[model samples]
Target: MIERVLAIRHDKIGDFVLYWPALFLLKSALPKASIEVFVAPAVQALAEACPYVDHVIVDTGDDKATSQKFIERNYDAVIVSCSEFRIYKMIRHLDSAYKLAPKHNWYQHLYKHTADAQYKQGEACWRGGCMLVEHFLTQHGIDIPELPQQYWDLSAERQKWRSYYGQEGNEKLIFIHAGTGGSSGSLSPSDFANLSTNISDKTQVDCKFVLTYSGAEEELAQQIFDQLSKKSIKVVMAKPLSSLADFAKSIVAADMFIAGSTGPLHLAGLHNIPTVGFYAGRRSAPIVRWQTLSHSDRRLSYTPPIGKRTGKNMSLIDFNAVEKDVVAYLDANYA
Candidate 1:
């Protein structure tokens, strides 16, 4: 009788988004249970927006206070989706009957249940997360069903942002984020500008582009804006929003999203919106490993070759080939 369950994934925005399916499956297995999550302060708003989560506790980086808060709740089960040594230290004190985590650290023996998130070359990060949850449930004599593609009903958020952005006459809105957030390799402003121009010129669909950025990325976004302006493409800079949750709401208005493997791209995945991602050509960060959480048919990805000169080089990814495939994707889906 796991009536109260707590899951912890206090980490990056992209990783949090990828872990949704695991949470979804957990809720499905224990429908009547009260499911809550502990998250990083940076993703508090986004975590609150998750339909699968009932409550979100923001880790203020104070281990004592945060642990005390959860300790009062007396959760029956705890699932550490993204395990950290710090997390283990705090939750180890929790009197929960069942605690599950991956078999990663030496301290993993602290967990009552530990499962191997069988690491393999070029596998999606979320697959391992799902394995952890499935393993925990099966050990408890609960049957786990196959996961369906996930989507959020953000219609109100969509309507609110679409009203603000103001689409004219059935134009398909495309949001392009040029900065990499220092997470992986990405294209130059010139490359993004040229690709946008090619899509506008070649695709049969009537498309409007919104250049999105925050912090230091403003310069990168502006450069692409200027280039597209000179090329006569229908483009505009996205209005700055107050928070990540607000930005995610704006993404709901977009028909498509494009970026390097980064936070904003995964925000679009929350809606299962069509996505185009540029991934680093490393074995650990392959196109498949970091693919957007969108469904298979909704995502298209590109990466440079895996080698010394090419692996981290975004310039080596053939943008011309990318442009052709993007144009074809747009025409097929939008036209």
Candidate 2:
């Protein structure tokens, strides 16, 4: 009956966010099933906030403790959303009837079944996770539907955040996140400053730029903040929150989000917020491959030219074109 299912994706925050769509499909397809998630400690808070999840098990990197947690649960199915050898060793001993993962590496054989969820040139990474879940359901004689769009009902949190920040009702909130998390190269401070200025000048609607940052990237964000302040733009640094979940709640109020491919950018995607992302031109991390988990109409991306010399080079992207397109999008939708 597949009464209990454990979906594992103990990876980076951004990748975990992308896996939400697949998680959505799983819960929708099997509503009666108790769906739990195993995630890294850093992602535990956000995982708990997910509407589709019933329980969240945080991987504390203590092998014996983690193994005990899994053994006690005795899941009916284990879907390794992001396959890893370490993960294989953790769950292989479980007596689950079905253990599914992508057809990758020799380690994949540890799972009871494998699906062709291999990454492709132009497919969103989430689709591979979707395929794995879909294959699992089909094998058990379950019918699944097309992927549905997702939204969060964060009205209370949004209102509290807006009130706390003194966000004016008339101003459109645009969050500009300058941190790249080192996953991909990002635009320079000057590029972000110019783009923010272009947006302010071109969009008819009143806009408030919120500069979001974490850790040592405070310098990067401050650089953009300073440049925009000199131009007399309405910009402020996003207030620090207690946790990643709280930060995500704050993002629910944003009318638009802009960042290089990073965790915060994907957190904005959780609300289906209109997102504009700067991506690496490399094949593995192209705009299409790591696209935010928003509806197609809500996402806009830019990247450098594709090649060894330019693929990961942020300077090679056309900031002018990006600025124009972003301004146009804001005018058409929000204005």
Candidate 3:
């Protein structure tokens, strides 16, 4: 059995969130093994706080230093969750007896003599057997009883929200998250302004709209906040949270969440909160993925059906379509 494991996944928040199952499995299988995680600086704080990890190393963008640090660790096993290329390179530098990596096209270069296993990411089993996280564990001869939708305790986070809004649990709270990373077309400030204004005008509920995002999207967040202010929509911006637990608590305390396929959506799923997820494209994958793991959420994609096949183009999803679904979901679940 492996005695020490070095897990590497230096990527986004969602990437880290998806791997929580795998981390739990590794710890359960090798109870005495020391587990160290390697992640980007942005995610280092979360990794350090993970209950399953023994140590967390931040990637400083120095290949030589990183390689030397790995070499010095002398781990008995290295499980690279990021990708095939990183696994291959890291294996060559380590004195590990086993290397585990997800299956990909680049597997041809892996050493034949070393103990290796093929893992499939995002695989779902009908008996709840296979999933991206379980596949990794099964490859390592470990079986997990259940895949937990991971969450962090946000009692403090709840307090933050309450203090910021002066909310006494009497007023209805609606959180609108418009910050999605990468190339996804996030809701424009004007769109949020219109939606919040329309909701307040049409409904007589004592509602408050809060906008949340990582500081990276500050400019866009500010624009949305400004637009909502002019319409007299009670808007609050979430300051940078110190931990995922804080973030999860804030989401759980909210009455309703309307956001993109980002971290907040996953948080809502974990907390069993009623959520409306807005996707740029109309494919059912996001909904299917979330629904398989959660019970109290709805997904709305922009892509429309054409003939026998669904359109792949995401541009077809309009602002009106998003607003309609949001309103419908709030009416059905929140009302």
What is the TM-score of each predicted model, taking all chains together? 0.95, 0.94, 0.75
Task: Superpose all Cα atoms of candidate 3 onto the true structure and report the RMSD in Å to 1 decimal.
Answer: 4.7
| Candidate 3 error regions (>4 Å) | 28-32, 84-87, 111-136, 139-141, 153-157, 201-205, 214-216, 241-252, 261-264, 267-272, 282-335
TM-score of 2: 0.94
What are the RMSDs of all candidates, in order? 1.6, 1.7, 4.7
| Model 2 Cα lDDT, one tens digit per residue, 50-126 | 88899999988887888889889989999988788988888878888888988988997766699998767778777
**Which residue pairs clash in candidate 3?**
122-132, 282-303
What are the per-residue Cα lDDT tens digits for candidate 1 across 188-219?
A: 99988988898999999998999989888989
What ordering of candidates by lDDT runs from best to worst?
Answer: 1, 2, 3
Q: What is the per-residue lDDT of model 3 for residues 1-335, given as tens digits with 9 covering 90 to 100? A: 76778887888765665556567767766778888888888777768766778988888877678888888888887766665565467557677776655544556347433222332234321112124335545666776655455444455566566666556545667777778742233566666668678876665456787777776666767887898787777877767576765665567567777765456666665555566654434343443343322443444434334322434333344656666666676667556
**What is the lDDT for 270 in model 1?**
78
Q: In model 1, which runs have C-alpha deviations exceeding 4 angstroms?
A: none
* Clash pairs, model 1 backbone: none
